[model samples]
Target: MDTMRDRFAPVVSQVLDEDPRVAVVLAEIGAADFQETARRHPDRVVNVGIREQLLVGAGAGLALTGMRPVLHTFASFLVERPFEQVKLDLGHQGLGAVLVSAAASFDWPAGGFTHMAPGDVALLDTLDGWTVHVPGHPDEAETLLRHAIAAGDDRVYVRLSLQANRAGHPVDGKRPLTVREGRSGVVVAVGPMLDAVLAATEGLDVSVLYTTTVRPFDTAALRRATASAGTDVVLVEPYLAGTSTAVVNDALADLPHRVLGLGVGRGELRRYGTLEEHVAAHGLDAGSLRERISAFLARRDAVPAAS
Candidate 1:
C-alpha cells in the first residue's frame, strides 16, 4: 500500500509499545500490519470484528474510563456507518479520542460505495471541537498521529488516503503551510490534494498553500495568505466539494474576494469505481483541475479593473 495507511501501522505499534494510556480498538481493519501489534498488546488493541457501532462505543467507553482510545477502520465504517455513536457517544460526552480512518473518499472503490466517505469532514463539521487531520504524506500522517496522542483531552480525526504529494511538508497541527508564491491568486491545497493541486496549478501565477488540519479552520493563516495574494483564493479539498468554503468565506469577510471549491463532485452519484475513475469523474484529475482553475482565475481577471 503506497499510502498513509502503510506508514500508520508502525506508529500505532510504537505507541502501543510505549504508552500505557494509548489503546487501539479496531473493526476488522488494520489486520495486515496491526495484527501483531494487537496480539502483543491484547489489552489495548481490541478488535470488535465488523460491529462498527460497538467499535465506536467501545472507544468512547475506553476514553470515558481514562484510556486514550484510538479507533481504526475504513472511513466509511468509522464515520458514515456508526455516525450517531460518533455524534453522541463521543461528541456529546465531550470525551477525547483519536479516531483514525483509512481508505479515504473513494480509495477503496472496488469494495464499492459501501466503502466511501467524501463527506466525512462535512459531517464532522456539524459537531463541535474536532481536530481533523488529512495528511498529504506518510511523514505528515505519523507527525499528526503523534500530535493527537500528545494532545490531552482533545478529539482528533486522521483521514488517510492513497494519494500523496511528491514530498512531505513541515506542517503543524494548527496552521496552513505556504508552499509556493505568486501574485495572481492563492490556491489552498487541503490534505491529500496537495500533489494534484500543485500539478493542476503549474505555470499559473497563483500562491499555493497546504494544510492537513481542516476545522477550527485556520482563517488567520488563510486570510494572511489570501490578503497577500490579492484576496483571491481557490480551495482544493480532497473530499466532498465545497466542504470548507463557508469557513473560508467567513474568514475572508474583511474584503471582497472570490473562491472556488474544487473537489469530488457532489452531483456525481454513480456507483463507486476505481480511484482514477472517481477522481477523473469528479473533475479532480490534473487536467480537469487545470482547466477549471484556469478558467476561475481568468474570470477573476476578466472582472473590470477597479477605478
Candidate 2:
C-alpha cells in the first residue's frame, strides 16, 4: 500500500482539483480513500460499488459528456471483469480516459486466481492506439498519472503492481531508459520487474533497459539498444509470459539474433500461498531467473562466432 497503490489517490486528487474536466469513477475497490474526493465533487466523483460494468460505462458516459474520466480499480475488475465495457464503451466509442489498475498480476494472492489480471496488457493490445504504462514504483506511478492527465485524450493504461523496484526510472514517454551498460546482450525490464532483473543479472555482461510504456513498443529505441549490444535480447515482463515477444521479434526482424522471453506462466498454478511462494512457483524469483538467464547466455556463448 505504501508503494504504487498509495501513490494513485494523491495524484488523482491533485488532478481533480486542477482540472474540472477530470472525473474519477470507482467501484468499491478504491472507494474508501477517494470517498471524500467524491463527496467534494458529488457530480464528478462516483463509486459504482462492485459493478465494474457500470463503473466503465459511467466513465464512458462521463467522457461523452466532454469530461476526461479516470477509472480506478483492481486490474481484474477494471479490465477482465468488465472487458466488454472496456471494448465497447471505451474502445468502440473512440473515447479517451486514464485507466489506473491496482493489484496487478499476483499482488494480492490471498484474493486468489480470480483477483488477478496477468493478461491485461495483452487484452489492451486488441484495441488500437492504447499506450500502456506499467510503473514499477510509487514515484513513477505518480509521474505517469500526472503525464496522462496533462497529455489530454490519450488512451492510457497505468498498471500499478504490488511488486516494486526500489526507485523510479523516470520515463521519458518516448523511449526505453537504459539504466545499465553492457556488450553481450540487452535485458529489457518491464515495470516492477526491474529490481528482479537487476539482481538476476548480477555478474552478467548485459545491458538493462527499464520501460513503463509498453505499447507502441518503442521499437526504435529497442533496436538501437539491442543492435549496439550484440542484438541478444531478453524481455523480462511482469505479466503473462511472452506477451511482448512478437514485438521484440518484429523490432529485430532484420537481424540474426537470440531472444529469451520470461514472465508469469499462462497456465493456472491453482495453488494459494504467500507472494514469495507465488513468485517462486512462476519461476520469477531472482535466483531462478538468474539461473535461467545464465543458461540462455551460455548457449549463445557456445555458438561459434563468424570466422
Candidate 3:
C-alpha cells in the first residue's frame, strides 16, 4: 500500500497536466518527485529553495494572478515556519491556495522534533475559512486533492501522512462516513487513525464515524451518531490530543456529553525511536487505545440516571 505522500506527486502531476490554472510551489522538500511534471510545466512548477516564507508568498501571488496554487513542504516548515506569511499573505489578503504537507506528526521520528508537526491542525484552527483534509488512504487523498484544486480559490490544506489504512473508503470531502453502529457511545476517528480506532473498539458497543475531511466538522453526522448511541465521544486523531475537543463541545453544546480526546500527548518525548515505538509511547497503539477508551466509557456506567 502506498503512503499518502507517495501518491501526492502522481496526483498533482496529473492535475498539472490537465489544469492549466493550477500551479505548484515547492520549498525543496519533495522536488524530485515532480521532476517530470516540472519539465513539462516549467512556468507553473516553482521551487523556492528552502525559503518557506517565499514558498507561501509565491503561491499567494499566483493566486492573486488568478492561478490556483498548490504549495508543498514538510508540515513543520510549511505551516509553523512561514505561519506569518500564511496568515497575512493568504488569510488576511483573502487569497486561496492548497497547502499540502508531508510528515504527519512523528512520521519521520529519525528526523527529530523539527520534522514532526503534531500541532499543525491546531494552528490552522486559529485561521478561518480553511478547508482541511486528513485522508487515511492514498485514494481518499487523490479524491480530496482533486476537490481542493476545483474548489475555486478556497484556502485548503491537504495533510498527507506516512500512515494509512489497509483499504480506502469513499470520501466526498464533506462529511464523516459511519463505519459501524453500536448503542453505548460514538468514536470519531480522523484520517490515518481509523485502523487503530477500529481495532480498539472491536466488540465494544460504540458507533464509529470515519472522516478524511475534518475542517467542516460534520456536526450532523456526529449529532445523529450520538443521538442514538448516547453522548460519549472519543476523538481518535493522529495529531495533538484535545485538538478537536473544543469543536466537539460546541457541536454538542445543547446536550450533555463527555468527550475524550486521544492522540499525541503535549509533553515532548525527547527519545528518538521508530514510528511504532513512538505510537506506543504516545498511547496511540491499539492496546493502549483499547485500555483508554474502555476506561473512559466504563465511567459512564457509574453515573446515575437523570431523575
lDDT of each: 0.86, 0.85, 0.92
Give me the candidate number with maximum lDDT.
3
On residues 1-307, what C-alpha lDDT tens digit does candidate 2 reach at each position?
A: 4788898888898788888999999998878888778778888889888899999999999989989999999999999989898899989999888888998888888898888888999998988979888888888888888888776787889999879888877676567899888998989999989999999998788999989889978988888787678787888888988888888887878888777888888888677787778788888888988998888777875542210
Residue 25 in candidate 3 has what lDDT?
Answer: 96
Ten consecutive residues with minimal summed lDDT in candidate 2?
298-307
**What's each prediction's TM-score?**
0.94, 0.95, 0.97
Candidate 1 residues 1-307, lDDT tens each? 3568887789988988998999988888876677788678888888889999999999999999899998999998999999999999999999999999988988878787788888899998889999999999988998999998888978899998888877898888888888899888989898878888889988998899898999778888887787667777788898988898888778877788887888877664566667888888888888988998888888875542210
Residue 232, candidate 2: alpha-carbon lDDT: 78
Q: Give the TM-score of candidate 1.
A: 0.94
Clashes per prediction?
A: 0, 0, 0
User: What lDDT tens digits, residue by residue, belong to model 3 across residues 225-299?
Assistant: 999999999999999998888888899999988889998998888888998899999999999999999988998
Error of 2 at 172 (Å): 2.8
Task: Write the candidate numbers in order of decreasing TM-score.
Answer: 3, 2, 1
Let me know the TM-score candidate 2 reaches against the reference structure. 0.95
